[model samples]
Target: MWLFVVLGAVLVLVGAVWALQGFGMLGGSAMTGSTLWAVIGPIVALVGLALIVIGIARRSRSS
Candidate 1:
């Protein structure tokens, strides 16, 4: 449960960075200004959010 939360948080941060880079908000990377990253980033973030929700739900249920 805790593992899920930790992993999810990391993924969320990574996804945010990817999205920013994709949108040209962040630079100096190969992914900057790439449309593919722009699309993939949000998807990854959503997945992370789902994992976080699952972790929280499971933790609450166990408690």
Candidate 2:
């Protein structure tokens, strides 16, 4: 469960960065202003959130 939570958090951060880059909010990368990342970023973030929720729930249940 902890693993899930940690991995999820990492994914969420990465997704946020990707989203920012894709939207041109962050620069200095090829991904900056790319439409593909803009679309995929939120999806990855949502998956990360789901993993976090699952991890928490599993932890609670195990306890």
Candidate 2 matches the true fold with a TM-score of: 0.97
Per-residue error for 26 in candidate 2, Å, reads 0.4
Alpha-carbon shift of residue 42 in model 1 (angstroms): 0.7
lDDT of 1 by residue, 10-50 (tens): 88988999999999999999999999999889888888998
In angstroms, how far off is 22's CA in candidate 1? 0.5
Estimate the TM-score of every prediction: 0.97, 0.97
Give the per-residue lDDT digits (tens) of candidate 2, residues 13-37. 9999999999999999999999999
Q: Which stretches of candidate 1 lie over 4 Å from their true place?
A: none
Residue 58 in model 1: lDDT: 99
Listed per candidate, the RMSD to the true structure in angstroms reads: 0.5, 0.5
